[model samples]
Target: MAALRKKPRSPFWFACFTLPDGRRVQRSTKETTRKAAQAKADGWEKLSKERAKARQAHRVIADIYKSAHNKELPDATPRAFITAWLTRRQGELAPASYAAYSGRATHFLSWLEAAADGPMADLETRHFTAYRDALAARVSASTANHGIKLLRVILEDARRDNFIADNPAKDCGLLKQETDTARRPFTLVELRSLMGAADEEWRSMLMFGLYTGQRLGDLARLTWANVDLQAGEIHLRTAKTKRFIRVPICTPLMEHIEGLPAGDDPKAPLHPRAATSKQVTVSRQFGELMAVAGLRAAVNHDASKKGRGSRRAVSELSFHSLRHTATSMMKNAGVSPAVVQDIIGHDSAEMNAQYTHIESKTKRDALDKMPNLLKP
Candidate 1:
């Protein structure tokens, strides 16, 4: 019911009424007479009622669509649907992938704020466009583009399940990757300098990276159980790719391993501190090592802070660059392309993208021919 009340010392009556959305608000009728004020209030209330009824009518149309199609319509909001989807993907996606997907999804929900509470079907392309642009402005193009790609995949799954009629993110193309920050393989001289500057564990890690072309995360988490001394191989399932590969233990790596005393527990980490360290921690430590070797300048905290909200400069050399170096050195050694591809390459086949069905002997031959990193 609409009611008329006087404000502080006003002669005019104010009409207080509830909107269709359930918010109570006051509006001045500008009428001093009671009769005129009551009439205006009644008229406003009637209009709000009509609007509420119209909203209900649209809801009925949804029910009608479901009845006509013999299927139930999805009533989940963006938050609800995205949360459930992430829960379902926990087991399906790799740890790194799930972490990334969850982070981006969470970020999207935060960005949406109140809109996240709306129906999943209500999302439009503008939402994705705004999000992509915002992310790009705050982060790097590669990061924003990767998030967009992941969001597209998530929404496409939603569309297939009838949560949405179409994927709004389908049209949001990825940004161009900034090639200036692209990582390059380390030169042999740079590699030698880094090795000389590093401690025992870091030196071993570099050797593994240069010989096996494995990522820093994988190397940091390696245990004795992952090594087969007799078989001359290092068995590991890569953290990011979830690809199980048996990397041949090169002569230099074998020599390095042979000098170390074996541990009783197979589960014991080869590098105790590194095994427990987070990937970023290991990376930062390596960055410090790079500074010591004069391969890169010391990290400046103030400069890094000043660069917030913008893409910070990335060095062309890092621990991961050793993977590129290993690949480059193998090719330069005249190893066959097919053999090199099998050794450090990902399978292009979508279904078996995590599995490489290459011969062990061929990969071993490729590693044997790789120029010795320690000698030169």
Candidate 2:
């Protein structure tokens, strides 16, 4: 099923073989010796014929290479591969983003358990599919979808690096969340109640959420240097999008910032507790505030024993509602969709499917039109 052909101009022998798909192809053996070149050709054809019957097709590749050249191909465990991938990616990703990636990957590995310690080349679609289904049974659909998507990205790198021949997750579709609850922006009445229930620090964070229209993680990580009281604006690069945005500080936010004590170090976080705490911790604290304001029910640890068979309850509102609240108010105030996205950091696909690059003056005017939640 294979033969060696020598080209008049080339120094190497060419292996002509038929692929498993019944198509004939030629590959440069890169060896001038007829004996070595034929071995390589024979290996390629054997791999194609035997790969379909093997669970570890990558291992089959290693076997053929060993027999042909007597050289071992490199390999890694899933845990080792994922860990190395995360380390390499740390320089390119933000702190929150890296943490999120690391956390989801932990769940992925934990799901794999004993199997994760085995060779990464041994991985199959069934392993990932089982993890996805298992995760879907335990967590919310949104969370399950995000986990699988992140796994796909991680494994995609593995494929590019020759860890695997194919990506299993590439074809594994997301779960259909028929029961997904739609998130709505906070009403002014609800904002007033939450404000009344919040402490000084939380109140400040909420104000930033309403005014800047940034995510909680970004707002929580804000520092004094990010705020320019003199310039009447806040400057910070969002963690997720990494977009450097300058949002005009409105009346209420400006008032609140002026009242707070300034820190000598520019890097000193604005909300000390929130900045140092995990996102889930800050989110829990906000949930408590919402409980006090009669916005949501308080969690009962005893009631939380609902196992993997039950899906986590979806809330119509959370701290994220503040982000929606900010966007809603901005759009309601006659600010264009582009201006809203400029503030909210939404992709054009999420908005009017159009983007207009707006100047700071145009953005300032848009913020000025938004309702002042502190007054009346």
Please identify model 1 stretches exceeding 4 Å from their true place.
1-75, 240-242, 280-304, 348-365, 368-376
Q: What is the C-alpha lDDT of each candidate?
A: 0.80, 0.80
Q: Per-residue CA lDDT of candidate 1, range 1-376, in tens?
A: 6998998889999999986657788999999999999999999999878756654554466567667886534444678788889999899997768888998999999999998876565676778989999988867787788899989989998878866656778967778878897889998789889889988888888888888888888888889999998888899988877778888787788888888767799999888889887666788899989999998877655655544545455677888888788788889988865567667755556524654366777788778786676786
Off by over 4 Å in 2: 1-57, 60-74, 307-310, 347-361
What TM-score does each of the candidates earn? Answer: 0.71, 0.76
User: What RMSD does each model have against the real structure?
Assistant: 14.6, 10.7
Clashing pairs in 2: none
lDDT of 2 at 334: 84
- Model 2, range 250-323, lDDT digits (tens) per residue? 77778888888886899899999999999978988888898899987766556556633466666778878878
